[model samples]
Target: MESLSRAGQEMSLAALKQHDPYITSIADLTGQVALYTFCPKANQWEKTDIEGTLFVYRRSASPYHGFTIVNRLNMHNLVEPVNKDLEFQLHEPFLLYRNASCQYTVSGFMTRMTVTG
Candidate 1:
């Protein structure tokens, strides 16, 4: 009888531990998280990417900031408040121009890799 009681107590304790949000780790989720992919073939390159907004939705996260996959900016300007999706061209770099304070421009080609078949 005592062993059964102990098992029930342990089960309840485990359930409470799982529900305790303070103890569990939480993400400081800001901006958009995306996977930028590219492929290189001899002298040419191939690329495919998903913007941040779509990436967030696919991962079951709230996309409050925006899309920023193919974009690359300086660490300073990367914290801007983006909304919905980032409507930029494909394979262009959204760079934080070193001269400007918070300027972001989409230009240049992205680095490439070997795309999987």
Candidate 2:
């Protein structure tokens, strides 16, 4: 587990872009957090018309240790089909494996690890 997390960090991967179209509609319930519409004119943070897809990011803890990738469930290598929910959950540190293409590195050593499927 620790090794997987370490590899993720060393790779320096992060949530890059959304798979949805830019013209799509956004809901107010989630607010500006999940998505942000890009404005080339202003170059500022604006509510995006499209929904946000999951991306890859490295999670780490010890400076001396390495990292691994909690990659997307549906998509291998997380190149496409970005989703935030996974089939399982980790109980060690209380983290949810959001589906399909997002890889998240935990921040610390988990006391336990749990998966739904």
Candidate 3:
């Protein structure tokens, strides 16, 4: 799993563009999900599951608020389909998958990894 994540991070944009389009709709891909998130505790990317909506990132005070989307488990390296409902906020950092062809399903903000005091 770790190796797959690393390989995905190493994928160049040029290579992704050459791959086939993410030729499926959300309804079609829901059951066949491939989720991803950055774990600060683990200090690496990890696979996860999504129930409904996935918040990729919230607008942070810092200027650097972009996120990376990766193709963790998908074999074909399909692109992320654009959905108007998937995006929110204009000025704030929006969910922009760097590689249009990488297969990582949904990118979003997850509270599952929070440390409890």
Candidate 4:
């Protein structure tokens, strides 16, 4: 009887842990500039140019899985928001240029495992 009770308690703990939120969220990424790197070929990592600013609007998170949907400034791809997983590593944060349009852009963040070599 005691063993069965312990098993139930463990399962409850596991469930609670699964419901935990990922560390990063949309609010944290909004208004920040980000870069995404993808390897067009094996052993080579390619990074996107700093074309615009990043605006994270919606995000889904859990202890082990999560993704963010973000909008970029000046990058009108017709594909509104981009999806980024939490596992991706966002690099250094810096500032961007503001032309006559009076726009403020951040440096940029990068995706995880963009390069293998």
Candidate 5:
């Protein structure tokens, strides 16, 4: 029984490593829009619109450690039709960088729109 349990644990760990070794905590942000205002100068506020498919993960060795966000352009880019079934794949190389506040980091390409009121 002990040997079987040990073998099962090793198999599970191996499967996890084979799935995704770098990225963790991924979320789908398809068709989501974010609205915010930025104060560039005194008594002035600029409205901004951001929309994309967000992919968040944590990678210790990554330059942008801690929490990172990725904007996946295509919804189906991360998945494919395999034998009539959908299979996930991590193929994109994200360009990581810290935000202005230095809190977290953001990666990949995202659409940014400036709203004029």
Candidate 6:
């Protein structure tokens, strides 16, 4: 848990460096908890109870190669709030931008292995 907190702090610092309007301060990350569960069957992370803006760092190969934000509000203009699980590949990386409230909880699972001899 301590390591995760430190990592969140570092990510917040890096986001600030980007000077992105969507990115918020480190304080926004306070009181936030991250939970992870591994599901070997799917080989993907099932995320739930996510209440915040999610930012994905796009590589140079991507068209919008920068920090792109994804939030429930902007997700296909849904009439109701999201209540379903969002899945992401374990091999891919995901970054949280900011939580809407301090009480919000972010949960997911991921596993990646690198084989280099």
Clashing pairs in 5: none
Q: How well does candidate 1 match the true structure in TM-score terms?
A: 0.21
> Given candidate 6, what's the lDDT at residue 40?
53
Scanning candidate 3 in windows of ten residues, the lowest lDDT window is 22-31
Residue 3 error, candidate 5, Å? 37
lDDT of 4 by residue, 1-117 (tens): 112255754553343334333322222222233544434465444435444323222224322222232334443321122223112223344323332333222235432112110
lDDT of 6 by residue, 1-117 (tens): 113467766775575445544333322222232343334587654544333332332232212223222234334311111112332233233222222222222232222222121
Q: Estimate each model's TM-score.
A: 0.21, 0.18, 0.24, 0.28, 0.27, 0.20
Backbone clash pairs for candidate 4 read 34-109, 35-109, 94-107
Q: Which ranges in model 4 have alpha carbons more than 4 Å from their true place?
A: 1-34, 40-42, 59-86, 90-117
Order candidates by TM-score, high to low. 4, 5, 3, 1, 6, 2
- lDDT string, candidate 1, 55-109, tens digits: 0111122333222232233221122223333343444332222212332233233
Tens-place lDDT digits, model 3, residues 21-104 = 221111111112234555668776675643332212222233212222334443433333333323432221223232333432
Note the Cα lDDT for every prediction shown.
0.28, 0.28, 0.31, 0.32, 0.31, 0.32
The lDDT of model 3 is: 0.31
Worst ten-residue run, lDDT, model 5?
79-88
Q: lDDT tens digits, residues 31-78, model 2?
A: 011223234587654532333223222213212111122233333222
Which stretches in model 1 have alpha-carbon errors above 4 Å?
Answer: 1-60, 64-85, 91-104, 112-117
Against the correct fold, how does model 4 do in TM-score?
Answer: 0.28
For model 2, the run of ten residues with the poorest summed lDDT: 23-32
Backbone clash pairs for candidate 6 read none
| lDDT (10s digit) by residue, model 5, range 1-117 | 112255754553343334457533322222332222334465443323333433333333443222211223432222111122222222233233323443222233333322121
* Distance from true location, Cα of 82 in model 4, Å: 9.4
